[model samples]
Target: MSKRKAMPSGGSTAVPTTGKRAARPSFEKPRGFFGLSDRATTWILAAVLAVWAGALRLYKLGHVKTLIFDEVYYVRDAYTLLREGHERAWAKDISKAAFERGDIDSYLPDPQYVVHPPVGKWVIALGEWALGADNPWGWRISVAVLGTLGVLLLFFTVRRLLQNTALAFLAGYLLSIDGVHLTHSRTSLLDLILGFFCLLAFYFLLRDRDHFRDALGRNEGTGEGFGHVTGVRWWRIAAGISLGLACGVKWSGIYFLAVFGIMTVLWDWTARKRYGDPRWKLRGFALDAIPAFFAMVGSAFVTYVLSWSGWFASQGGYFRNWAAKNAHASNPVSEALLSLWHYHEEMYSFHVGLDSTHTYAAKPWLWLLQLRPTSFYYESYTYGEAGCEVEKCSAAITNIGNPLIWWFGTFALLVTLIVAIAKRNGTAAAILSGLIAGYLPWFQYLDRTIFQFYSVVFEPWLIMAIVFVFALMLGGHAASRTRKRIALLAIASLVVTMTLMSIFWWPLWTAQVIPYDLWRAHMWFDSWI
Candidate 1:
């Protein structure tokens, strides 16, 4: 396999433009730790991170023993979809009590009016099929699996970008211990699964950037529109498919699809200009942007439509035959299409008009600031009840992020934005794209009842931003031994501190029973309760 030179982590250092070649800085197969080769150390770190994240997510998987928060809707929908290929409504007078008693078949035969698409629930159903549907194991195992793999994905992504294994591992470690991610991973929810696909798409696009630039470099001799067409971009297609799956999970995925598609074209445009394409502006749009639009957007559209195969195949799904009842069509296929369009319109209306009052509802502005996090589950008990040795005990699952990590990441995010604008660093711009794409769109709906948990979609990018600063502080490969040591110590201290924060907050994050005072200590703001 051909190795593309990794871009520098953005800072005050002299960075390269899109096409300019920088000094190598000497990082091909650096010495490994623990008497192992560099390759062996890298894989070992990956394995260790996977195990650590998996243990955190999978430990006491069914300890809660009850469906909390959104699990009530999604876990039920998954079971129904597993059995009937469509969501069935819950029976009247049936609550979680029966569900916890191994009574998974508590749903009526009538189809339910679910707003979101079915792909996420189908993913949930896979675990349900493997384990019993009535238990927490069945409901949560799939998300745990995705959450674990997401840590590894972030590690490999940073490794590929910065080409520094230690710094890459640092990014992965930060993600694994984040509170919002941990809560979503242990519970049955669509958002984290949505996040996984979005990050996966980002990784693919990063790979495409390398391949497209390589093709451009190879064609420096030909000098015709920067080498034919750079051929077909398989990585871009894979990215589109991953993003389509994200849309299948939630409508929020559309923002990512549009933004990432544009970002890729800009990367190509920059490469053209850097290579001295005289008519780069017009040629970029004509040659690169148009094909990219079709390649990414068209593929995403097709994949999204195909994701509804389960709905189309079923006769009893909600509004399945709306066209037949209301509008006339020439054929069944056209009728199905019309019905699907109508269903989408109704879903759109519901989303726009939803203004439900809830204690934990927060504006998008407070998400990264950690002002008000949603509570997934909370239960209090007096003495002599449920392992309560103290006067009162609390078992809660709070979706607040790790404080020190987020504050540092927020700083990193600002620094990256400044570097991108002032230096026009492509690396900073690309890193910032994921955070902006995931986060900024929500601001349009300031009045909408959203939760901080949605921030999971871009949390990996936030960590990437954090790692970018760490790379800069560590200096380039040419830095002195003492300088590198100080930077490494600073990074190591942050990791150790964040790990301790996770430990302090884990009981509240996971629904473990703890003293009321301890739980209250974890709550720094009244709004957090």
Candidate 2:
């Protein structure tokens, strides 16, 4: 008789015992009407959390009427994307007052040189197309909507990845109130789109991993390698599409593509070796990894090409005629391709050489600690102006994260990192992999102008790490009820503290007119100033 043990929900296969395969752990598949099962419950709870997050982001969203920080670039770029098929140059005399008041009829007729791709601007353009482009609310609506959807997506992803409903909800709730997340969602910026798309891609890849594992489990001892687990991997293809869109928003997303693609291949290799397949590496490479390349990298390539349709269709886009004019290519299509490559080369040059100093620019090392929080907007209003009744008042929108979430979250990441290295905890590795993908690349560009607010791109993974720490505190399902209750209380207190911190700093997150002293109170450190 085979000795059996229960597998924790959302965990990988059991570790190998000496000279023998470990007993396969049993899983419980809960069933419901119409075959919904756990998914039905997850969707309902996720919906509630998403609505809560969306409400907070959407509340008084238009309070700050002017473009804040980088919004001056994106909001105008979005409108330009709509007015012209691609980005267009602005006249030196373009009026900020008239532009904000919905008058944008005087842009130059030539294409403009832009570093980033067009997808995110197109997303912002969608909101401006529906609502008038003149208002702050219109330009920011798309980010708020995607940010809310990202919260729900994170919940579903955690539930699927961990197989624990409680952990999933905790992850989503923490993200819902995160100051950095809320600030990005309410602002018209490209980073929110980049972050949301990266999370979406990760969610798809996680689902793909589950599907791969389920295939292996279903056909145990049946194949030399992954030969018996031939299933249509739609999820992997979707991940590619999401990653491509992420890259289309910002070049930084390429890091996720490379990291996740390599990770999936390694997973296939490990699964084969665990199942006693001879020549596991070769089979994993030939049989699994090759197919995955087409599924992920190939799909991503197609999506990236399609994202350039606007620039391709336009006759007057920047460098659109470069190959014909300078490179002297005869075929129009070939010329267009050459022009696109040239444009990318120029963009790459700009990224590598961007060392201009800015007040809020920070090094990647300081980002993890959030030593300098970037201020997006600030205005001093005297009494009788902007409804200020105090002797001196300040209205500001600062992109600072909730201290409890970030500070404590950093500790959680350290713990998870140790577990991943020491015990080879699959859950810890999965969470940390995302953290590294979204972050580490920034270190190479230390001399470039980067801000602490960019940490929002990896903030979801940080929250997930915190949730894993909570799971450890809960002592798993085997813990005594009394112990579980105590752990739950501790987790609840931390969450409440995070929420209160958000409220305390809410005025800074939103440009609410508060007394100068009150605003200063929210700035906890000199660096925050």
Candidate 3:
């Protein structure tokens, strides 16, 4: 008879696994809820936070009544896109009055020469289609929904990447409270929609990275050919599509697409070297880099082209038949494609030459400092005029971020840079990628008229950087209990300060009719006014 192996001590018959890495603490994975898994509990907590975020985003959404700032352009564009098949010119100064009076037919016959793409307007049209376009709620509902969902996306992304529920909650909570994000989410503009896609692409890229690394670790020694045959990375493909959608929203997203594409190839190269491949560069270029380029950039091109389906279908779309008229192409497909190319050239020229002065234009360098926040709406009222309880009152909607959060976040980025360079933390580097993609490109456009509200696109990355610093402060398992408590207290204090500042600035962000003194209190800088 075969000899039976003796069991371990303590009356246990469990077999120990060899060569497995130790996981993080069980604190991130709490016990099941009502016999359900820990995942359900996590989702429940995220939902609770999301509900609060949704409430804030949805509350008084219709209170603004009139379209503010760029909404004047987008709201009508959205309505026209739905009513007509394509965007049409509208009476800019007088059409808003007609629209507010419930005259929904404000658009004229000619297609408008718009600079931006149609995907963002299509998103707004979804809201307008759901509810009639005559109301403020219809114009702003989709942005509110996306803004709320973005918080959940950030939470899950952090939780999935780092496996830290506390850090996930902190990132999402900070984003939810940030005034710039809140303001942009409420407004019917392209930037927030653009931000949502960029954030989604980031989440997918993280998933692809995790999957790739895990596969690389598992199959490193076994592969004899050009690296381990990890199958098509669907997450990476999804990221490409999301980035494409982002480009359709605003051309600024192309920076992210290019940067992330390069970053992913670098990730693959480093991963191969880390997994014991000496000649990683050659193998990675042929095996990983080529495939990743097709996966991301190729897919982005297809998705961006598809976003112009409406314009393609419209016979009278701006320059839709320019090839037929100007080029006289015999091939139908070539004609359409050439016409689209010519249209893009015009749009490119418009963006490059956009030097018209505006009251709220700000330099990209000052965006991070919150030096000159764009005021979307502002109106003063004497007592008894428009819900004025004081002798002088003000109603305003400003896209200024929380000062403490912005200033502290700026400092946190410095910390991130140190960690990225010294500690070689990939996560820190990824956070920097978003900021670089969103903020750096604007400097080239110093002559172009841009507004501070565009900072909303990178606000999530700022919050992520802040969370990374906070995570560092909370020391590793080797830390003493006293040290942990002190670190927690400090982090708690900063969060409380951020929350209170958000409270103080809430009225200014939401266009609430308030006393002039209260409004003046919010303008910490003379430039803000």
Candidate 4:
């Protein structure tokens, strides 16, 4: 064989060598406690935002000084739940005037048929127990605290999900000041508690997603599937408990429980495939899906049953003796269980058959647009009355959303749905998933009398969708610095505008005295009245 010519030093026949830049590593998953980075900054910002939100909620919380709207039912029930183990019947046509003047003897001595479960009342009872039940501050304090904590929770959750501190703070701020959220926070109500628990459950599930992903990645290329992933999955169990608590507050939380359970299993399937398991589908089913049912669904069922402990432990609770009086009677435990099931059946029927008309009743489709805002409390004063200095003054607590946030956020939701489908983006898809869990279920009850405030349950998700749109505007790391700065400025302007809107609507949100015409100006739609 002929010998080949020797190549020159530092040069080859293949080509002249040229310097090439090393590729940067994939985006580093920031590390610290619970997947949060910039620990001091993140926590500091969170605490400040939480305090600000709490102050806004707590300000004038007792100034209304009386039960407003459903506060009559929930607040009174909360007090009775503390004193009596169950809600007692109220005198028919009870006088509100008497009840607000420290006359709480309106309840009759029999068990009242309550539509909602006891957990929400239990939470409210904490405040009533701590403070005096006769005080409005006591009635509303628990929900206000929950609402503030929800703002903080959203901040931490978004920060963990996107790993962006500024964006997370903005998300928290928007939710903190939004009109509907603010109003709910200031009032003694169950929906805010329901929203709080649902968001918490979602946060826990998000944490679990990462935990499972990291575990599976550690076992990369192992055909062992879930055998290596087995453990307590405490975060998932926590999510289940949160979901159950949410359901205890309202039946609507069942939608979140169902949707999140499905989403988690899908995540596991993707994780198995990414980890190089060719038999991912079957293995994921055998390992993840089956176990998840027990982990999430089973845990939720157990927790939900446990939440009714107060009702179960009490002999005089409504329907506690239904099974004893009927065919399902057995032992006391079995009778109580059966009676609870029967009570649930009755509640389901009542909810499904309800078609009562109300001034504030709104369709689900119109909720995104805020067409029919519910007036939780409204009072008109003549000039000098109630601290009013105008020709006509008004004090109101309306469940209207921040128009700037809701209207513009509607577009953001559309973008999220489109981006989710077009890019097959997991994060965008997850955002839409929460929105669906919160809002779409109401469409099934179009014939029922649902109010606009019910949208509070999913308001956090809507804010997340809006933030996702802002992320799209900010562009990727490869985008020019100038482009990114412009995007940031544009997003900042919108946020500032939302803040200004929050101020303009703050009087109505807090039931502060404002000119009648000003209140009218805030009510852009005739239906808002």
Candidate 5:
């Protein structure tokens, strides 16, 4: 074969140039829509997640026909909102008939003034509206749906973080089996809504990271030392909104907004450095980080205020007109808004100083081990009453987590902290930060009467931390097949253990009619009972 004419000494060779390959597609986009491609494997995993989350959230959803725990508060508040334009007080017996015959008018017309924001109550109202007034299922259905969505969001979030389908599924599976999550899902509670929003904010921030990095990689000008990209990331904006909604659900969510916002900015700074930018640190802060802070935190503030729409509109809400009556008045509307804010300040003060004794109060340090899970509902039943099967039976629903998951997961978090400090792994650091955002702040209130069940807000992130460490243990994709097998077996064992523990705890968490002896049998520790 005639070799291509060697034109000159420095001429291009025509021997097909096989040694130097064509530029490979960027590692940034690894298949699928937002990496979710039409691969059979992806579809199969999606189907599996759908079934897992659905089964956990939907099975025996109405087992406890009566209100359970916090459901009594949220369900009633929701019904009142549906009838009156604001929350109203209800008679003690109203819960018995409020669901029947649409008699929600048992509530007073004046605003009853609630501590939590109304968005969660509105969410609860959706189920009540759909199923009508008298159905317990109606009140709980929305929370169940939101809790299930949290699972799926968690799956996607972990999938993005770990870049492994198996690890993502492990996180989702652990969350599904968590007894606290199960109880919260079965009841109408604001914390579950807060949890869902927190997870969503995390998911959106992940999306923002991926998109921002992809944008940097694609911009040829960036290679020439561009200072910063001014692109408006819709994903980051959505994350801001979600973080705000989380805060609206509970003030604790502000911690997430603050931490994740900082986390995203740091991630951008690092991405810039990794791409060989010279002034990455300064430019990342001045251009990328500050704007991101505004988008996330500022937007969250606005969203949180918006959640008080009813309080703003109604004249009878507590403190709604305080500013008007006091010297703080500027204008009627402005005064009313200021008064509402003053009310929040007072509430915050109360929350911070709450050192009163409570039967189920727990220190933040003991929360990880569930040393004092709150008993949401408890009743001792006599034979032939309340479905008692023996001489004396018990029906209870405790907001406790699966012991295997919580204990092992907390232990895994300790390992993750060590690894992050020693190895400086970015993923490990990120997972730890999320857990801290949800948990560590509670330590500031150790003297306050915070219950262990409040840990539910951050429980999903704890599970994520566990899976993240497990992913690290599994080694990289190039690891030996034997190592991968061992990792899989270990993870499978953890899951199996968690599932069994969940089964044992299910009756107590759901108030099923079980013999008092059986209930006691499930209570592995005196603290748990």
Candidate 6:
């Protein structure tokens, strides 16, 4: 036999002894979910997004010398926590004196009972600890930092989900310009901290999805199709920790934990099916889904409890002795724990029973369309004190979303839902799922005092929805050059429009001292005013 010309090892022409195709240099590594063109462009877009988002968040972060809206509660509470290890009561109009006096510790130590969780207050405390209670910048610094980080996280997340760089940048840009996000970032508030943790949880979950898929891709040729799956996925574990931290920030995060748990299971089922396993769904349910549930949800639950370590350790936090008071025979630790549980039960009841009317409260349906926005701060200026040379002028920071972006996003969400159901496209479905997780639950609370600003929690998802629609408008990966060019132009136009809108509204969002008439001029609707 013509001595098989000694085959060169590891060359393209050489067949592997394992009976697999020799790895081609170009195909050695898969191009990830999206192709290389998509990846390269996404990195460039993400860089630009970082600059845009950072400038919006970090610039003039301390312009407002006094506390605004909920900052009145949180900034002082943070100072109290830093000095006294617990929140303390503040006098009426404390914001004015607190700013002037530069210290609030002398007014602390009463164990001020607040409605919200402690985790967010702790976050605020970090800033107070670093910058000192004397400075407003210290209190607001953490929020601005977290907000900017959120933008970067959303940019990478959208890029990965859609496999398109332009769309990712678009999502980031929308978030950067959103009034609610900008306003919240400049103030010390629990919601912004909550939003940051929620975004982080989503980020970690996405990473878990990517890593799980990669693991499956690697094991495709293992041949032991139904083998027992046992390996420490550090990413999955990290995702668990993140989900727990999310809950630590706010109980609203529980909804995400539930929604994402189901979504992750579905992802596992699909991964196994794509890898050619016969009972992929069932195997995934047993192997992948359950493990993920324990990792993400279980860990989150633990973290939530751990967040109250101060309460458990102390004897005077709200309701700390409730169980002991009611059930005298119970163990002290058990009673303390039970008392906390009872407090939560009461809080849940309050939240559900909250049907009180408020001027700023809007129905869930109105939130998506920006029909109503909460007025965080409002002041009237006669002729010149507030920078008005005209008649009646008003200066306000109204937590309203950009009209064009919100309107487009609402419509885009509808389109994405349709595309997800009809086309069974994973990208569209993922985008819709995220929006639904953050927003749909609010509908059940319609009777409650809810403001459109609360929608900041879901604003990132809305931006992603808008980007998803724009991506579809831009045509698919295989579209002709002419179509692609048109799509690019359309996206560019949208970005420019959003940028202009942001510029016009920047003063209100940042509390910049501007011509009061100019601020009023930007208010296109009576409801906005």
TM-scores, in order shown? 0.93, 0.94, 0.92, 0.92, 0.89, 0.88
* lDDT tens per residue, model 1, 1-529: 3334444332222324445443223324345788888789989999999999999999998999988998989998888898888888997567566578888787888889998998899999999999879788988999999999999999989887777788889899999999989988999999999999999999998899778766766666654545465778899999999999899999999999988998898887766665556666788898888888888888888999998888899999898899999866779999999999999999999998888887888888788778899999999999988899999999999999999888889999999898788877777887888877899999888777788889999999999999988987987778999999999898889889999999999998888888999999988888888
Residue-level lDDT of model 2, residues 399-423, one tens digit each, is 8888889999999999999877776
Query: What range of 10 consecutive residues in model 4 has the weakest lDDT sum?
Result: 8-17
lDDT of 3 by residue, 1-529 (tens): 3322332110112222323322211223335457777688688879987898999999999997887888988888888888776789887677788667788785788888889998899999999999878998999999999999999988887776556677888899999999888998898999999999999999998888767767765654554543655898899999999999999999999999998998888777655554445566898899888999999999999999999888888888899999999866889888989999999999999999999999889998888889999888988999999789889999999989999999999999999999787766777887899988999999888889988889989888898889888878887566888988999999999999999989999999888899999898887779999
Clash counts per candidate, in order, are 0, 0, 0, 0, 6, 1
| Candidate 2 residue pairs that clash | none
Give stretches of model 3 more than 4 Å off.
1-37, 220-228
Q: What tens-digit string does per-residue lDDT give for candidate 4 at 126-152?
A: 998888777898888999999999999
Better of 5 and 6 by lDDT: 5
Candidate 6 residue-wise lDDT, 1-529, digit = tens: 1222222111112223332322212212213334555456566666777777778877877766667787887877777666665567766666447655775645644567766667888888888788876777888888887888888888888766765565666678778888888888777877777767767776776777767666666665666554454476566667666667766666777787788777767766655554456676678877887788788767777888888787787766667788888874367767877888988887788778888888877888888888888888777777767667776566677788777888888888899888777766666766666677778888888678877877888788888888878877777656899998998888889879977887788777877666666886877888776
The root-mean-square deviation over C-alpha atoms between each candidate and the true structure, in angstroms, is: 3.9, 2.8, 6.6, 7.7, 7.7, 6.9
Best by TM-score: 2
Ranking by lDDT: 1, 3, 2, 4, 5, 6
Alpha-carbon shift of residue 119 in model 2 (angstroms): 1.0
**TM-score of model 3 (CA atoms):** 0.92
Pairs clashing in candidate 6? 244-300
Q: How far off is residue 202 in model 1, in Å? A: 0.1
Q: After superposition, how far is residue 172 of candidate 1 from its true place, in Å?
A: 0.4
